[model samples]
Target: MSEHRILKLFFFACLGVFVLHFTMTLLHNTPEKYLTPRMESYSHLWCYPTFHQGWALFAPEPQSKHKRMEMRYYGPSGWSEWYRAEHICMDQHIRYRVTHYSKLCHVTQNTVYHLWMAVDHFDQQDRPAEQFYPQNMGYGIAMVLAENYAHHFLPEMEVHTLQIRLILEDPFELQDPEVIHFPTKTLMDGPE
Candidate 1:
């Protein structure tokens, strides 16, 4: 192939991948009922690190609420003060050039979003809180991530159980903030 033709072909291929990536990301993030079985089957592609999509820059809908993830740990000394993971990650990101700090900021955002979605699902079904925690994937992931984060940061304290709470406040200051409490997960216990 001629050089010009090769360059043109490469451009189109790059464009194709860009378009496909965003299209798959949109479908993957959409409600499952809206997707056909085949599309739903490919949803896992977006979960890959290379293809991951986030809404911080341009959300489909504007974010109207400020969400914060706060965690507290229970040890022999009793429950510690609620630690704001988001703030810590943001501070680290601001102070250092390390990429892990930025990644943790994104992780905190995803954790809050996942936990909130799980909460909304349970609320709509009128499910009991006891039954919701174990069955929800988001809850399970959040609990484990939160516990690990606590253990990593507060190594001196032995954390038996960690509790996470999502604080949602209106970005415009139009309403009072609401706190969604999650069950305290036992981190020291072995897997069931």
Candidate 2:
């Protein structure tokens, strides 16, 4: 074949591969179960960490609610009083530091929420618990908070364990709304 014809053939082959790869990625990401086990395995092995199963962030009917995280640490003396992780926006007089801390709180909340959604998805799919728990963002946030409390809040004390409680409340409820708590435990000794 002529050199021009050979380059044209190579270009077409590349285009075909790209189209096929895109199609496979779409199929892997879709919620519908259509791919065979072998294809699924291939997709998981190759496309993982890039394409994930679909998940909804919120329901069609959004709830008017507020959420916050409170944490307590086990120190040398005993368990310290619960400290609320206040978002910067919640403060009456917001300084630069307050705004920075508030942004951190927002990021932590978002990460935790995403982790919860992932856990829910895995549970619905009946996947093994070991697949997604240890590396989750919720556990990560707990560890970071424990370390911060030990180093900054009480430098003299060493934090052994942490209890992180996520409180959720619906403001629009007519009756008194009991805050929903998702309590999580974390060992401070774990890898940072």
User: Number of the top candidate by lDDT?
Assistant: 1
Clash count for each candidate, listed in order shown? 0, 1
TM-score winner among the candidates? 1
Write candidate 2's Cα lDDT for 1-192 as tens digits.
999999999999999989878877876786657788788766665564344311224445444445566667775567878766554233522555544556655665675575456445655765454555446566565557545645754667667766666565553334454443333454555321
Q: Can you tell me which runs of candidate 1 are displaced by over 4 Å?
A: 1-60, 189-192
TM per prediction? 0.64, 0.46
How far out, in Å, is residue 191 in model 1? 18
Model-by-model lDDT, in order?
0.79, 0.58
Estimate, for each residue in 59-142, the C-alpha lDDT of model 1 and write its tens digit.
466666778889888888888899897877788788986668899889888988988888879888876887877789878878
What is the model-wide C-alpha lDDT for candidate 1? Answer: 0.79
Superposed by TM-score, candidate 2 places the C-alpha of residue 134 at a distance from the truth, in angstroms, of: 3.3
